[model samples]
Target: MHPFALIVSEPIKIDIWSDIACPWCYIGKRNLEGGISSLGDDAPEVEITYHSFELAPDTPVDFEGSEVDFLAKHKGLPAERVHEMLDHVTGVAANAGLDYHFDTLQHTKTLKAHELLHFAKEQGRQLELAERLFRAYFTEGRHVGRIDELVELASEIGLDTGAAREALESGRFAPAVQADIAQAQAYGINGVPFFVIDGKYGVSGAQPREVFARALTQVADEKAA
Candidate 1:
């Protein structure tokens, strides 16, 4: 037995912070799913929660350009280099079963989208809405920042469109989004796709599935001891 082992049994809780506009955040989502899938019957009971983290909180709702131009200008990189980076990330995402269409992507503020996610969380559909928003932005090029579009997306996922519209219009979940951001700041997390396991272990970036699997296994083992 390990000398430092602590013994307790409980479902593992993973709080993930990410944004829809972040390409790696989408990849990280698939990787985490893959990791859980790899555990198969041996996996422990897990509760996964998604938190708000806007990569571009101050971006305009109606950004007037393609994603490539947005990135090139925002990051001060050459257009060619930005394209190259997008191409490489696209390839990686494709390998993870994600289709990224940077050419048609709409670059917009994600604060509203984050608030919508908080609403979905209250309705017990946060992860579903998160996935939908990610796909809407990266693959479908939908304007997730728009209230009408968000209401439509929520309806597609069987969430009450009227409720979602009211919430968005009233800015009900805005504080929840802000709370998540403040928590992230307290943790010193400045990047997207950050995962906190059981409120103790923090894993950053789009780590490999094996990394997640190992962390889960280790946490479970320590708790079981």
Candidate 2:
């Protein structure tokens, strides 16, 4: 091999459409990370970008119900059925190393939270903010819809809280959020935790870690070819 011969591998770009309020999205995130880790030294360089997708756009900023109540009404399912579903998802989340607290979860609009994600993206802290928001809402039962609460989360992640507050309050990233939604619609996506790998493959739902690993490996192989 010539010493001047170099191997250049381009990173796979993954566009993820998820809502902060979606339990499956959080679980899927963990599974995706797990998949990447499973590859160990063989893991390909990858860039992930989270896009906005509102699961409940009409939910009030200060929704007056528990997660179960909200789901029951939103899906028009019986209260008992919602409880069963939450229980099942809670177990699934636990398997993904997540502690979902549906009882204490405050179901509210996630538009402001999505806006904050865009602000974080501008600061190159989008991934950090996304993880923080997921844990805050799912495990900590923190209110993610309020500007003040979001600003606090931003501060926790070493962001400029003042700027975060101003951007969120002024709706600076609303259009970006809307654009993401429009793109999702164009892709015929109607679910959360949807993964688009290298603009070629579409992997939907909170799939097992092995599934994600296969997708990543396939894309890497194509790039190599």
Candidate 3:
């Protein structure tokens, strides 16, 4: 064995702070995967952890409106402009192989959804749950803010349904969710789909595949040095 042979002390960690209801976050997730794919055979070992960052923490659990309505009212944009924004993003999501049914999306608060993700993290299925929740909220129009709906999502991912319900009911993982939010704030993150690569590099928004590929290659090279 060569004395100076390169060895990874740890997998390159990508901490992504995002919310389920954010369409761009879903697109960013796909773009990150595309970036990893761009690395091909030389891709570095990577570990991704999704952190909670609620886009609308103050939103009611049972918001009586469509996502477009919420966004239009919240941002004070004309309905036409909001629809245009959503249409542009929907097309972008399609390019990334996601079918975003914004018209059918059930807009609701994501606090309980974040808590469910924390619980899934404890059960070693955070990634699965994160993907499921994103798909559910954006594509399937499922009610993520409700306890019954969350339990169904948990069961769909092979988690213990009763346990998930209990966690939501008892607020068991609420602290963990809040901790993730605090950590994001400490990192000075102000948006979703923000990526922190290897704890030093920060990539914001749904960047191109080449961008993520370069970051991984650069980090891997530095580790070898």
The estimated TM-scores of all candidates read 0.95, 0.97, 0.96
Task: Please provide, for model 3 over 82-187, each residue's C-alpha lDDT reduced to its tens digit, 9 standing for 90 to 100.
Answer: 9999999999999999999989988899999999999998899999999999999889989999999999999999999999999999998888889999998998
At residue 205, give the lDDT of candidate 2.
100
lDDT of 2 by residue, 41-143 (tens): 9999999999999988999999987887899899999999999999999999999999999988999999999999999999999999999999999999999
Candidate topping TM-score = 2
State how far residue 37 of model 1 sits from its true place (Å): 0.4
Q: What is the lDDT of candidate 1?
A: 0.92
| C-alpha lDDT values of all predictions | 0.92, 0.96, 0.92
Better of 2 and 3 by lDDT: 2
**Candidate 2 all-Cα RMSD:** 1.6
Predicted structure 3: lDDT: 0.92
Clashing pairs in 2: none
Number of the predicted model whose lDDT against the real structure is largest: 2
- What is the Cα-based lDDT of residue 93 in candidate 1? 98
Runs off by more than 4 Å, candidate 3: 1-8
What is candidate 1's lDDT per residue for 1-225, written digit by digit as tens? 798998556799999999989999999999999998899998888899999998877689999988888888889999999989999999999999999999889999998888889899889998899999999999998998899999999999989999999999999888898999999999999999999999999999999999999999999898787
